[model samples]
Target: MKLSLFLVSTAGLWVAANANSVNNKQTKNDVCTHPFVDINGRCLFVNNFAQMDWDAARAFCAGFQGDLVTLDEANLLADIVDFIYKEGLTDRSYWIGGSAGAQTGAFVWPDGSLVRMGTPCWGVLDNIQRPGAEPNEKCIALNKDNFFFFDNFNCEGEISVICEYKFQRENRWAEGGCATMKSSAVFVFLAAALLGSDGATEAGSHVKTDVCTHPFVDINGRCLFVNNFAQMDWDAARDFCAGFQGDLVTLDEANLLADIVEFISKEGLTERSYWIGGSDRALEGEWTWTDGSSVRMGTPTWGANGQNQQPTGGSEENCVGLDNANFFFFNDFPCVTAMSLICELKL
Candidate 1:
């Protein structure tokens, strides 16, 4: 009688443990139905209110607990349009992850996934072609004039931003590999958790942690300078700076100019006039950016007739070159001077 009673107790305990395990599995499966926040089955709405560069916008989204807008699934497009209308984003344009930044032909999202947008679909019937249109390049923007519409803007242009959160991928294991060894070894070496894609190690499979690094780094994390140029034309310099995840430096304030001056002074780039984008080539006496935006020469950081000098008698200071001392005025340096210009991109 005693032996039979012990056997019954052991069997009952085993059944209860198994039942609990089954219930836990069902709960985990049910939770997988929701992708992420504000997103119903892989759709989300994001609205922007500030003008920023493509890179700047991406950074904003990452901080918003989301990644830069990626047009992958069909529902995402519809959600974005609805958000734009609801939020009344008719002030200016915004940027999405359609640009080939820092690299070309390889367009990837902030998460390093390939860009995948469905057939060209715009909310409005605007004749303007977006990034995927004929003669298309990778770069999309939210246009304000055409509310609920998108167009292809230059990747370097500053605009507002939006982002969407994505779900972490579920990992799995394959057969006939080193996965078996990892599982058995986990108990033996319990000091450290050997992390793998699906909690199992396999040959030729690399497990990666979700670590994000900034593309641009500086000594003080404020101003970034690219100081590697021998002799390239202004156009070539601009291209080189853009390639470095930045553009020819634009000075919006005196402090920004001071930062550049400090950077140049530290680098000992004296006696060389670097090319900047402050050329009045298209319009005389009226400064404009390469992207064709009005530039207000806020304050003179130079002596009288410093940047105001039209050396070429063309009625415009087409190119800018740095001089010594607190005089931060730019002269009409020839485009072919090949001086190293500064490139400042949004982080």
Candidate 2:
């Protein structure tokens, strides 16, 4: 019997809950680095934090000595989605390696494998031409806006990235021999490679940058921003942050609660509530951050409700916010309630 792992020549694919838990059928020995987890024989990095354009996304992956992930394997999509959801990328799309810009109508991966297009692979659309027929939407993406299935997206659209690394580097990259790029992205990747030849910036830049940019305040060691001006509902607040490649703030750090509260208080902003990205909308009372991390409850985190406790509103208050009524500690509130927001930029 020929040895194979995760390479399925079939149309049907299953959605897995964890990348490592998938039935990827192969002998294992390859160990991936931090952030890149081993799935079958492949090392995959699901970059849910930083959002970049398709070309920039590929370049970012190249920084890690990898390339934008290729979904040639049937079970890989399932595994990738499993990792994405686990990372709390339920609201973001992702740029992959496949593009039809090379052949116009034909889509292929960096490895020259034909980009699969079908029901379980591509999301439902009027005309499913795999890499899509739209001239503008040449880059392939697992679009979160369109049910996390393959969708041809605009090359310039900024979204998340799924980087793939291999022990045998010959499987990917433009220099591997065959011409795989869609068009200008090929040159972009080469330029980035040439620029990185001197090794000034390491591949670790994929996760988090050292310094926070404008609008994002550097608090102690973290990057955060308080939108004390615009009042929006919980959903709208999150979407607003998404535009900035960020999301609603999560008081994850020990000193974040005290520092941020004090900062906003000095701005005279704590007098009004601010959305802070904790919600039990998926499951009532099970509060979690957008990335699926459990929100640390009680103690100095959540506020009190009279003689009871905060989060007293139950399902009606699925969304969480920093309430001034409770001295700016955490409090559950209706998701529709308009409140100014606190954003955390991952980029």
Candidate 2, 1-347: lDDT as tens digits: 11122322223221222234344443244445555666544677666668899889888888878899876643456455655655556787888888874655677777666664442345544433244567888888887755466788888998888887744345333211112212321111112111112112222221133445556654534556678889999999999988766788766542356556656755677568899888999988788988888886543355542244467897788998887765666789999999999887653
Q: Model 2 clash pairs?
A: none
> For each predicted model, how many residue pairs clash, with residues at least 3 apart or on different chains?
2, 0
- So what's the TM-score on candidate 2? 0.42
- Clashing residue pairs found in predicted model 1: 52-159, 98-138
Candidate 1: lDDT over CA atoms? 0.43
Best by lDDT: 2
Error of 1 at 99 (Å): 52
Q: Candidate 2 regions off by >4 Å?
A: 1-19, 24-29, 126-131, 168-347
Tell me, what's the RMSD of every candidate?
Answer: 24.7, 22.3
RMSD of 1: 24.7
Poorest 10 consecutive residues of model 2 by lDDT? 186-195
